[model samples]
Target: MPQETNIPNKSILTPFNVVAGIIILAGLVITVLRFTKGLGAVTNLDDNNPWGIWIGFDLLCGVALAAGGYVTSAACYIFGLKRYHSAVRPAILTAFLGYALVVLALHYDVGRPWRLPYPIFLSPGTTSLLYEVGLCVFLYLAVLFIEYSPAALEWLGLKKVRNLIVRMTLVLTIFGVVLSTLHQSSLGALFMIAPSKLHPLWYSNYLPVYFFISSIFAGLSMVIFEGTLAHRFLHHKMDATHLRESEGVALGFSKAASFVMMGYLSVKLIGISVDNNWHLLFTGWGLWFLLELIGFVALPAFLYSLAVRERNLRWARWAAALSVLGVVLNRLNISVVAFNWYLPSAQRYVPSWMEIGTSIFIVTLGVVIYRFITTRMPIFYEHPDFRHDI
Candidate 1:
């Protein structure tokens, strides 16, 4: 038998799990109350604001957060930055969870979420950006499941299948990267159609480009953030080599993020200046725009540079985390905040307790699945000599 033992001895009652469970339960209860009543019963949404926090945070923000899977996999498999090999599995897993959550959140908001599949098969719309995103995301999700299958294979003691999946990983990875690039940019394209409705400050012809570039940082940042969480909570599940490998991935990601941020900053400056939208800077939204830029973009880019130069992985991790937050804010601004700029702030979509609860429940479910897979699979740590010569 291969050299192996069961996972570390830790009770399932870790504080994190307990807290997550409560949040989920509370959210579900709220959801039950909403369906029995109506959207008006629990939600603050009205005709003025059709979308709410579920669309802003869970769908838009969550997709950006999930960008890590594509970025890391691209670096390793496409770019052949082999030092980042260790980060690939976790990034893919996170992407799966992040997108999965978006689906769940949208399910709650749609008229008939159960009929979602109908759009895919029965009433497909090829020209719709949302349709493209939907198709691309669905295909990408399948790619992720395929890429992540080795973990399940290992858990089931199917060594042959695990080896086969690893061998075919290059093809699957290439497919995943292409789909991710398309869908991510398509997400930005979704807002582009609402150019007249979006705030003049954020809307531009280069929206797709900004969205794509920002997603690079978002993915990198998510990898760092999620890695920190897992390492802290699953201390006993870690090993020295795994930590060392992950550090290299972090450093590489930080440098890449810095470069991407520099490009993004240039576009923001050029976009606003060329269009003479400087007047918007004097309004309330302008202050928020400035805050988001300085707080999330400029600050984190500088910190990433400092961290990389100083070889300070800790600060780099924090910077990556901040970059991820910036990405989240940027996406939400496009989708919801800037979508209906003329609407009163009070009239904006506000999530009901049910919406919040369901979002939490979906995320918790993802965490549980991630934990369950990591506990028994080869997703986290792989033996250095375990290379398949396929």
Candidate 2:
């Protein structure tokens, strides 16, 4: 028999929803202008600054933040931490939607998005770092969906299909981990070739290591943040048991985030020492770098440690927010603020209204989709019929 669950009665016209709808509509209009008028018409981009917020915040940070999917999956499936099983579905959904948004934003950023598939099928730029990132992202997105499909199948009461999906979970999770590891590091590798362009404070030969390591904490922090929201707003979608287990999950995330944040800090310091650029610490740019390292990374890491020790979920959530902010700052520093560091201030690129609008559109779309799916599907709670099977 199919599982019986209580679906929440949510109105589609809340204030937040209305604002999201308006932003989405504006973004649609802006997108139309962008396509018809060419990149020059709606963007502040030029030859000196080809990439802006779309590449930095949308594609780069989006991919990094989505790391929760693989982290949660590996924890439950690979490491045999079944206690975390309840979080797996929501994490996977968040990751799948995040990657989808990254791809959608890329469509608006690229000169000709129709050529997106060229690397996969036609041109196959085997020698390019971007090629590796592209292929991994594309394949990983598919893997995320496959991993997440069991929930959808179960929601629809398709027992046979859901069982088939459940059987494939282990294999799919393995693939997700492998693919995520490659592309997460490869994104940093994309900037390695332009060491001269990136600021000394942020540039390093070990950038790939830095990016991959930081993503660990970043993803975990997001899980804590998102999980908190789920417990608050989507409470009706979750079972009492899931609601109870979520507290432990938040504490676990804090513990893991603290350790990873320490390692990331050490690695970041080592990267600076290796480059023999400690002298740059005296510069203005270096001060900003210090603020990022100390204010966001080190401070939040300490908070996570304290929170976990005290078992204070509230403090942990605050730390998680700061940790997420740290990752966003790091990506933006690398891709935009400190990119082309040697160039004059006037030459630095800033996103125009259209670019910002498009980015917001992508985010709002993700939120709407997440809200829709979690409300309708078996995301927050398992289907009773297959709970034992999963």
Candidate 3:
């Protein structure tokens, strides 16, 4: 008989869970306040700065970090890297949840949240880049759900459906890669219309390329980060096979991230050279840009090489953390900081308490949901009955 467990252990009201509960409650209250009182009431947004943390951090960073699903799946299934098969399901679940939370954040950012679905059925703006982003996000969310459904079906003892979904892994992985490529690049394309609005230090005609390439490393780093945490905290739930190869998997991910980071650094420098903005490195923002590139990108790449060469999983985990931070900082720099770099301090956007609280709430909610699913489903490891195949 297959074992089924929900809530995992008896001690549910731990300190972490208590804090998460408070944040979730506060977030729900803030969300209601946002919808009822209007965007102006709970936000610091204005004519000069319409979007805030929700869009910059939650949507942009959220989507980019969630790239683990496609990256791992493509490696395991499409490229026939069977060694990485154990990591695929967890990556997919993370991606699914990450995208779902992005949709929630988008709802708070858009002025008319109710009209979000209008793009799909009622008012199709076929020519807009936003339309493509919206359509791809909607469709890809469905694809992720479908990709992850087999795990849930297996948990529920639906063997027939679980096997059926497992067979579609290749097709689903290919489709996911295509959609992720388009939308990930399109995110950078979103800022192309604002050439003057973006700082020369960051803007480029090759923004789309930067986004796509960096996402590969970003996904790899996330896999390392998430996998490290899982192994430390969820050891009991993980299979022995997964536990044994986990270090090797982390090393492989770090090696790949190192290579991608090198390419990203080269391209970024080339972007600066092409714009003849090398002189900007002397200015404050220019120095910040250099810090991001060298400290975050170059330094981490070097550390990853060291970690892999020495077989230091600890150092690899550190590199992954830095890499994830670098990715988030890059997104925030582009969307929030550089977007209004030329504007005066008085005219620039700053998030209000309500806005900050709401962002916290949304993030907390995602964490809670992740916990719920991991505890209930066969995410950390395969169920015994479903062990022969994923």
Best by lDDT: 2
Instruction: Evaluate residue 332 in candidate 1 and report its C-alpha lDDT on the 0 to 100 scale.
Output: 76
Write out the backbone clash pairs for model 1: 27-357, 68-219
Cα lDDT of model 1 by residue, 216-328, tens digit: 88888888888888888765665565687878877878888888898899998998998898998999989999988889999999999998999898999889878878887
Return the lDDT, model 2, position 17: 83
Candidate 2 TM-score versus the reference: 0.96
**Largest TM-score belongs to which candidate?**
2
Per model, state how many residue pairs clash: 2, 0, 0
Give the worst 10-residue stretch by lDDT in candidate 1: 1-10
Off by over 4 Å in 3: 1-10
> Which clashing pairs does model 2 show?
none
lDDT of 3 by residue, 216-329 (tens): 899999999999888777778888778876887899888989998999888888888888998988999998998888888898999999999999999999999999999999
lDDT of each: 0.81, 0.91, 0.88
What is candidate 1's local distance difference test score? 0.81
Q: Is candidate 1 or candidate 2 better by lDDT?
A: 2
Per-prediction TM-score, please?
0.91, 0.96, 0.96
